[model samples]
Target: MLLACSGVLAAPTSVSAVSADGGSRITQVKVYPGSATVERTARVPAGARSLTIRCLSPQLDVQSLQVQADAHVRIGESSVKVQDRDLDKECATPLDDQVRDAEDRVASAKAETDSLELATSYLRTVATVPPSEPHSGPGTPGSASINGTTDTLRRSSQDLLLKLHQSKRRQEAAELALKELTEERNRIAGPKARTSTVTITLASDREGELRLSYQLRGPGWSPSYRAALDSTSGVVKFERLALVAQNTGEDWRNVQLALSTGQPTRSTAGRLPGPWTINVAPAEQFTTEIRAMPAPAPVAASKVTLMSMGDRGAETTPAMPNFDVQVSDDAYATEFTVPQRITVPSGGQRITLSLGSLDARAQLVSRTSPGVEPAAYLIAQLSALPGVWPAAPVALYRDGAYVGQGRLDNNSDELSRTGLSFGRDERVVVTAEPQQQNSGSAGFTGANVERKVQHAYRVESRHQRPIALQVLDAAPVSQNEQIDVVSQYDPLPADKAWNRRPGLILWSETLAPGSSLRFTAAHTLRYPKDARLQESK
Candidate 1:
């Protein structure tokens, strides 16, 4: 007995165990368009000759892993690989124990229900049994005794029935509790049981720190904007925000978060030029094919011009929480390092972060295109910033009320103004009549055909406050040398050159309350009767 006891207590020989190294904790995260970079740090023990650090996540990009350490620590070989891990190992929490307890209670409740059902059935049979003899004359001792027994049996049956009903209700409550607990457990523990592991080996002479950085593919951020314009104050309040999302299978808790406009997944190197080859086609065959093809569609010569007119304006907003972000700007990219630590859970949920706000100078202008839309649109002209402004979705607001949503065009490396259109301004009224055209022969032999058209527009401002108004109109452009096109404007337009769009005329004026304005445009064209004028594209 003594020998057996000693043998049981002795340690086993050739015991094999695989121990994982202490992993590092994430400290910094930089999110990009479709990927993110994670940085972690770990402390090495003093005088440790060898140390290992494990970094694990489900969306880790193994190829982009990098490591660094202090002077006293030297990084050795590192490896990254995907492995299957028990979901319970990482996801199990106190909720699991609670779920088990609830399941046990359900089983207990069902057992009690079964026992109560049996007792109720026995009581029912006893209550149903008829008296042995027929009822004697009333007030007889036999009748009185029988009545007492029957009353006692009926009361007992009712009590059993009530207990049975309570037992069923308890069972139902237990079942409901079990179902809720099960769902909670499933939610806490995700659907997958696999993750990735990154292992790094190092040698250190004294206590030091190790840093690991790697790219992940499952985290990203997008830009959103809010612009509020107060026409009365002539101020525009612009707020830039970011919507960040991540599901890297690892919660980023208390980690420094940074957002960048750069796209890491896109090619970084300059594009390589391919060989330019020219092949001479068979002239006859090409000509034949071209002739057989259908004639190209004719395009209209009408032109519509959109112009912005405004200066900067004051900004107004609620006081913003301090986010001491260090902004770094370069020709290639811009980065903002958030000062505060952020927490993002490991699910595809978005968290909004305030990037910053701008109080750009702006001006309100009412624009009308009577030929297209009779209603006048209230527009705000905002001066462009020096840096790159990536295209994003913007929500427009006017006078503390939401107007509509618009898209911000990409204006990187360009010095230009941005225009935001609020809903139609009912204070301004506009009307346009249909244009009239006449064609007739002209010149000596009647070889030339002349065309003339007239356009007329009327606008009125009914606003209590004075407003700046712009009316846009256009005329046909001549594309053929033989076609001579001339335009005449009543009360010459402010800018006839129409810098970007030819044949477009703009009229700018300041209108007082309850004022009206009218304008007209006349165009004439002359060309050979046999030749058709080509339309301007």
Candidate 2:
């Protein structure tokens, strides 16, 4: 049924509905990752016998449909029906407009073709007129005059022929488009009506509101964010947004929307251990949840000078792009309530709306993996986050300049902090010195093979102010008991096995303008000469 034209049903229809029936509109929607729960409220006068909510999406889950009324009003059994709209002619559908558009194009193209053909025919007739006796005098039409007239007719005929050909081609294209649209309609409509209706038996003592709620399949939302940083103030303003869309056949106008983390559409029952004999394994053994790659370590380094905080330097706190919203954190879900009523149309277009805004001091730091790349990256760290910041895309602004985009992955065991890299800082250059490696026999009897690797890295800063830089490198970890790995760092690293990740060395230092620090790490691995030891990438 006319998805393009489908609107809120003015009045719900029911066979036994009384005059007490009233208009119903979707008042609230709780949108999850893949589905949404829709709640529609209808107010009826006293002594109402039944209520019906009409024009529901065919994608709704019938088993989850429920109806309730005020305590005084009793809601009885409700039934969902997929009824066919029996009409003398085709009920209006979304494809009808497209079909008519194609028809108009075809008719216009055919008309143009007909006019061009007529003009071409007249020109052909004039140009093909048999050459009569040529008079060899002026004003009597000599060969030159005949030639010019012939040329004009030939040019006109050719132009008209080209026009006719183009018009025919357009006409064919329009006809084909019409055919495809018609076929699509026939296939989707499938000789049946797609409208839906829900009827609930109710007995009301006084004027009360009847709430009908159901789960729909094709409506969901995702989070988006825009963060602006003021370097002088170390303050960051965040504008939180949600991209919401629905293909549920009816427009949700003036609805109270809540973005929810709850997954009601998913199963709550824990998976029980199935009968498993080692020989006869269960069809589905186990499941693994692949977490998103964490954001770079919470390193806070600012491009602006540390002593410049008092100046403000034309960098007033950025105005936060925001909306009125309320956040509710329950045990099962954290929901953000959109304060104002919003409308999400049913054409599957993502409508962006603000969830709210927050202001916090951003901790900035520079991090570089000198072993892997020769550039240092500036990162902004946020220790305190919004009540609920899901994994989404982020647009960053630094010192009033647009930097770039980054993905926010907050699924960390440590929830107190998150970081976003603002791309590379060309001012800080990292140089990896040539590697030194050698192999030799270490045991007294030459029974042990020894491998030694020496790596040196240099990091220099070009910024006017000192920047806190952290260089990441790793020493090899051996799996075998007999394989011994020894690591030595020049001026020892600031944090060994940083963040509990074994063998990962993090070196932290403040580098001044034009100043550099050289870091050396030596790794020696010894194994029995008879055993095979392989290095991995």
Candidate 3:
């Protein structure tokens, strides 16, 4: 006897044969990837009865698919479920295949419409250029006989001018088309592709050890994994989650995937080395949870004391915490003096070593100093400079090897100690000496410089207040190869544009005693690249 089997039915091509295992004939089956999703409808024939559906893909193991007799359907497994109220009504529509064709045509129409709009805009702008006035008056000429000759010349000039204007109009039209295509491509491609959001969350469990939970979610679906933290040290943990795709389209087999903590929107400017592990979690839903483990007794921080020694070999000044010292320039030769017998707490503790103000000088003596000129040996000199060789760099060391940089100053006010490595003897030494700078004489040199091109450069004072620097680049840049200027330095406002000033390529700056500032500016060049290399005559 024929029995009603919900909405499932057999296709009309063949008759159902009785099987030895007493089972109804199986028909259509489809699979999707773990990363795909579906929202619309699939049609079921009227005669089909008793539909048996199963999700077999290992990547996306489906829990269940709920089929309704009339007006509704729900899809998902027992663990995850989504019920659709209008699924039955949507499925009843005829599948003529013409609807898909219509969608494509509509998309094409929109593209053509946008292209036409851009062409119209460019034509309107080109029409607005004022036409050249016709030169009409008594021609200044030799005589009636010369008039014939001049008339021929005037006709040829007018024709050439008209052609040039037409070429420009065509060029403008081409540029507009290119811009419109680029905009449409970006709109279709959507936002830039980026890494998927995968997060591991930590939590404390009833046991002494830490527990972990992992959550992964993107466009299609979300899946989670759970694991426990490491024993003894309850802070660190690891976990993995295997999520089969729920609604990936057919042909969902092998694929490539990975997880990462991408750069967040608000990243701090200056931070310590090692990975940027944020103290707080952003808007992320993890599939896994991690718990804290029992922590061991805390260790003390490392410390070193600085003691002043007198010529008699006895300690003159009281010992104080030895902080790490950094330099304004690492290339500069330096020396660090460390004293023995410093106080440390019972547990392991960390401390910093700092270098105070010291006298330093640079000299240009003959590689083999000739006894002739001592004054000539004085190349340049500075005295009583504080802090490390490199300005505002952190001091760090590990296994007697310098590791990474840390904050050099606490704030703008005073130098601060950058925390040391906890359970190791990491020490840094500085050797004091003078560092030579690359010095040169300024001269206007180079070839692309033309007599017509503007040439300029700026030179400034080191420490004094507002000093004027002159702009020198003014000649046509073709033959002259270099631009040079000499003057004192001064700080300028950030928002203001300095390069726009006539014949200027650089700005000057000045800093007071122990104070410093930095600025960046953009320059606008008036000449073409062929003239850039020309030096000022």
Candidate 4:
């Protein structure tokens, strides 16, 4: 972050010539989910004529570049130009010391390998000396002495070979380590590290600070939440975090980072409805016709119309969703200022930053739809969330143990409270009896069919304390006048439309320890025998 405030130029005369400067650094960054804005400031002495901020990444939106200075300093518009050479050496990752250490390790390993290889070669050379007319003395323990010497030489050769083999392996490993580190460092300083220099004409009567900021499309951050529930306290500890990353060929070192909910990269205006006009139509009729055109034109470059890439239609592939919940978040804009400075390395590597934490009022309830799932799920009904929270996946923990993942559905402008679901609770058992169905033809010579279905469910609580439980089920609704459906329950449900879901009924009560309850629903339908019904997911 040498760009934050790394330079101070000596006072120059009004006629001072323009020159590039490196004494500036990224001071602050406001990162949205898809784009980021970077601000750099530098100190300038009185009489300074112009300031040129050099080695800025080319990924920034040049049209968004702006220059601001003290009112005492008059400044002209800033212009950006692509630099002809490589990026500034300072723009690379701040891992030079690490890269050097890796290189040293490689060199040391190579040296050890070479030493071992030299010793092995020398051993081979000496082992071939050829006995040299051994003494020729009478009975000098002839054959035994020769065998002993051979054994010694063989043992020495084996040891040296082993040492050489191990040394080579170490050398290879060291080389690989060096390669990885070097590649990581170069990845941030590679060919895509093209840069641009922004020069802003200025005339200052006194010392002041020159600030330059621009919007970039590379860096982004997304909200991630952690919710931990303490059943005894009936409170959920909700923590906010952000996954931040960048690939702008520059490292963000301890910069003031702010996460904003505003979407500057999206369309600024709301979409207008196309049309709802209705028109009278003619009677349907089939018609066929054939039209032919001349399509033989070759070698006519002069008559060709030149068009840019923008003129061509582009096929954009839709992004794959992280979850099955297809929800559009249109909440009011909000911002979270990270309490501490953050650092995220370049190369799309993410680092999680903590935003803040708050406790939310929560109630734990066991709920189940026996027809859909035969087990009751533990749900945390939450209220009083932060002013605005975008829909995001939440990591759940109960009593310090990870429960599972949950979804936060408070992303709508009109919605406030959101419910979080934990995995099923086996302690609260649910049983759905077989559905009883009967059908028969009725109404004047079998003109219509009558069908009746009866569903029964039983729930039991094994908890030592009383717990609130909700049971839900949906009754069939007829869409056509020819079909008449009537639903009846053994005991009227507490809510006919549970959570605003039509046709879904809810049953609620505080179940005592080891207590059980039973409920039943019956539906009768009468419809034309030839009519068919379609099932929907």
lDDT of 2 at 92: 59
List TM-score per model, in order: 0.73, 0.72, 0.16, 0.76
Task: Report lDDT (CA) for all predictions.
Answer: 0.69, 0.71, 0.26, 0.70
The regions of model 4 sitting more than 4 angstroms off are 1-22, 83-163, 166-170, 186-192, 273-332, 384-386, 411-418
Q: How many backbone clashes does candidate 4 have?
A: 7
Give the range of the ten consecutive residues with the poorest summed lDDT in model 1: 1-10
Best by TM-score: 4
lDDT of 2 by residue, 1-537 (tens): 233121122223454334543567788888887788988888856766766666566777998888877899887777776655433122355576787888898899889889888777656544554457465444344334456655676676777888889889998988899889876655444445465677777776678987788898757777878888786676778888777877666667656778887767566675454453334445695654444544544422111000001112235664542356788998878898876666666656567777778888766678888888888888777775747777678898887888999776556633232277766788998899999999999988999999999999999899888887888898898889999999999968988877688888888788888899999999999999889877774
For residues 1-537, write the lDDT of model 3, one tens digit per residue. Answer: 000011222223354421111111112111111122211122333233222222111122232222222332222112222222123221111211233344444455555555555554443433332235332344322233233444675675566556555555555555555455444322322122111111111111111111111121111211122212121221211112212222111111111122111211123354444443435445595444444544644432111121122122235654553433222223523323222222111111222222333322221110101111111110111122243332233333322444443332322322211111112111111111222223232225432222221112222223233322211122122233233322222333321222344333232233243332332222222233233343442
Clashes of each: 5, 6, 103, 7
Query: Which candidate ranks first by lDDT, i.e. highest?
Result: 2
lDDT of 1 by residue, 1-537 (tens): 000000001112244222223436778889887788988887766544444432266567878988888987887777665655453243334555777899899999999889988887756544454556554554323323445665787787788788889989999999999888776544433444345655555555566787888898757887778888888887877777777876565667667788888878766665454565556668655632222334544432211111011111215542443575577898878997776667765555567777777776677889888987898999887667545556788899999999999876547412122277878999999989788989999999999999998989989999998898888887787766888988998868997645467777888889999999888999999999999666642
Q: State how far residue 380 of model 3 sits from its true place (Å).
A: 34
lDDT of 4 by residue, 1-537 (tens): 222223223335556643334377677888776788999888666766667666676686988888888889898766777653233553444455677888898898889889988887766655554555454565333334455566897998899899889888988988898788778766664544576777676777777888888998857777778998887887888877667777766666656666776768776665454454544455583553334444544421111000011111236743431211111234666776654455655666666655567798777889889989899988788654755666677899987889888766564422222267767778999999999999999898998999999989999999999998988988887778998988898777998777776678888878999999999999999999898976453
Query: In candidate 4, how many Å is residue 344 off?
Result: 3.2
Q: Considering only N, C-alpha and C atoms within 3 Å, which residue pairs clash in candidate 4?
A: 3-24, 3-25, 3-26, 4-24, 4-25, 4-26, 7-23
